[model samples]
Target: MPTRWELDKASIYSTKAGEKDRTYLDSAFCLTDDVSTPSRHEGRQVAIGKKVLQTLLTQLAGQGSALSRERTALVVATSWSDESYFVTGVSGKTDAPAGFTPGEQVAELAAAFALGGPALSVDTACSSFPYALDMAQALVNSGQADNAIVMALNTVLPPALFLGFS
Candidate 1:
């Protein structure tokens, strides 16, 4: 029989105040809000999508997601990778003043939550979430981690990108 990996916890963050009860029945969600927390690493801004994921992850951790954080793998999926640049624009900073390593969202999240297992970001356009899920399952199945957190975020899209996708 195949080992079952049950979902212990799930959290969601949206424009509306649906974070407390992050569920499919959230009654029409939107991502156009300026919902973002300040970055810890300078010169590196956190995109809206990352911000949303961070909030959800924080909620999970706060409510005790039953994760052995250090043994948990994190995989984030999204098509907007370079959104930090657009959000940051031209900040006359010397280095990554805020957000770590520049363009490395996984690194920042891992550091924030202290996830010591394999963590990575996946960008395969529209299907990135599934790809990330596969990678997460592979990590857990391969014994690299005890469990995994798969986050898919696509929000605060710029006008041009929104048009293209539309």
Candidate 2:
């Protein structure tokens, strides 16, 4: 089985400089109106997608989704390593800024909700989100865990990635 949410190409928290300069290329985002700052790492990280996951988590928990409680484990399907640069884009494929890491941040987010399942960071670039979902579903289907949270988060418009677009 498969489930997914692909955000349409639109501007939710985009900076005018990017759009106007033709340098900003961001994917559709799921964000809270309250959090309205255009993130420098809009496509690779700190994009509106995180807000989308949080919202979905809340809704699922409210509806009693299998992965709502503390017993549920979450496997984060990510592309860039926390050690990768937020401003530098995805790490494995390229070099990012110094001291930028995601492992600690991922753990912190999971801990904030008191999650008990195995917390992991997967770096599959572009495919991170769907992969994460698949991993979560597999865990549930295999009965290894009651529920799973797979988070796919990435930002865009990095200097290196621009070549692909051009």
Candidate 3:
């Protein structure tokens, strides 16, 4: 028989709130920063995404077995990965500051938590979060990792995309 995998811990951040729990559907809401903010090195989405990851780590730390540079996997799902640079044409400029790519964000978080597992970034439009979760679950189930961190972030709206839709 296949071993049953259970969701050990999870965290969420949004325009409305942030949450963390062991069960999948916990309804408790915690006050969090507004999801929209000015475009900068530490933009709104990146800030919130970091907060969500930190919250999850804090939760795990409370349990006395914090994932410290362990072989833990990281999976991030985002519709836009540092699109601000592209929208503002900063990416084309020679003096563009280092923007937070989705993969880079994951790497930073993993490094902060001392996680050494595989890292993945997924962009599947509206279903990005679900896909990230699936990937994390697969990593854990396949014995590739004992723990996995899955994060989904959607930050600033691209003016071009907005104009196209409008």
Candidate No. with top TM-score: 3
Candidate 2 achieves a global lDDT of: 0.54
Model 1 bad stretches (over 4 Å): 1-28, 31-65, 87-103
lDDT of each: 0.60, 0.54, 0.64
Candidate 1 positional error at 134, Å: 0.8
Superior by TM-score: candidate 1 or candidate 2: 1
Task: State the displacement of the C-alpha of residue 113, model 3, in Å, after optimal TM-score superposition.
Answer: 2.3
For residues 1-166, write the lDDT of model 3, one tens digit per residue. 0111111222212223322211122364543455464344434456666677778888888999788446789888878876543434443556555666777767766776677898888988789999999999999999889888887766554434433433
lDDT of 2 by residue, 9-78 (tens): 3322234444432334455554333556433333324334456556877888788863645567767666
Which residue window of length 10 is worst by lDDT in model 2?
1-10
Q: Judged by lDDT against the true structure, how good is candidate 1?
A: 0.60
TM-score of each: 0.61, 0.55, 0.64
Best of the two (1, 3) by lDDT: 3
**Cand. 2 TM to true fold:** 0.55
List model 1 lDDT by residue over 72-148, tens digit each: 88887877754444534234566543333323767776777788899888888789999999999999999999988
